[model samples]
Structures are given as structure tokens and as C-alpha cells.
Target: MYFGKKNSEEPEIIMEDTIVYACGSADCNGWMRKDFASENYDCPMCGSQLVEEVRELPKIENEYNAFK
Candidate 1:
């Protein structure tokens, strides 16, 4: 007996250590990667100040990844 075809599974989820600029507001839900954030250092969603935080987040999939 032999296997006809191997099942192709999705690529494993990749996690990465990334720095993010999160909203300082306690009641706001806003966060973004530091690299993609605005230079003004403000939350794009709630007009609040942003703070730096180190977090382990899922790898983001984007066109830019092709260059890496």
C-alpha cells in the first residue's frame, strides 16, 4: 500500500517579538507596530498619545514581507 498524495497544510503560525505603539488611553483599543506608526506618536484611532511596549505578536502578512 502507498499514499497517493500528501495533504498540504497551512504554514505554521509564526510569532515574533515586536515593538508597538499603543494608545495611552485606558478606555481605547488601539495599537500598531512601531515601524508603521506615524512619526507624530499619536494613536490613529482615538487621537490619544502613544506609548512604547514590547509584545510577542503574531507575524503580520503583508507585501513588504516579500522584501525580507
Candidate 2:
């Protein structure tokens, strides 16, 4: 059984596949997830380097910059 949220009841089960990755930077507590088929996968909160390996989010000066 899946651990995360499930899709609504439907004739066909559409499981949304995602890849969770940790930030490549240090001293940051951020996490990110990207579509399994996506080519670009970066931290949503902070534009930091991300790798397939589990890591910690790098410390960022400003988190709002990402929104701008």
C-alpha cells in the first residue's frame, strides 16, 4: 500500500509518481520532490543543488527569493 495521499476513486487507479530528494547544500533543512519523468529537479523552496542521493538542504540567506 502507498504511504502518501491517494487519488480519488476512479475506474482506473492513477498513481502520481514522484521522486523525493534532499538538498545538496549543508546546514539547511529543506526537502524537494519532482515528477518521476521530469528532467529538472531542484529545491522548490530554495534554488539549491539536488542529487539523487539523500542530503540536507543548504542554508539559504532568503527563502523569498525563490518566489520572486
Off by over 4 Å in 1: 1-8, 61-68
Q: What lDDT does each candidate get?
A: 0.85, 0.54
Per-residue lDDT of candidate 2, residues 2-59 (tens digit): 5997777666533444345666778665665432314556665676766664333333
The numbered model that scores best in lDDT is 1
Q: With candidate 1 superimposed using the best TM-score fit, by how many Å does residue 52's alpha carbon deviate from the native? A: 0.3
Q: RMSD of each candidate?
A: 5.5, 13.1
Estimated TM-score for each candidate: 0.71, 0.35
Residue-by-residue lDDT tens digits, candidate 1, 1-68: 98788778877889999999989999997999976765789888888999999999988866664685
Give the lDDT of residue 41 in candidate 2: 60
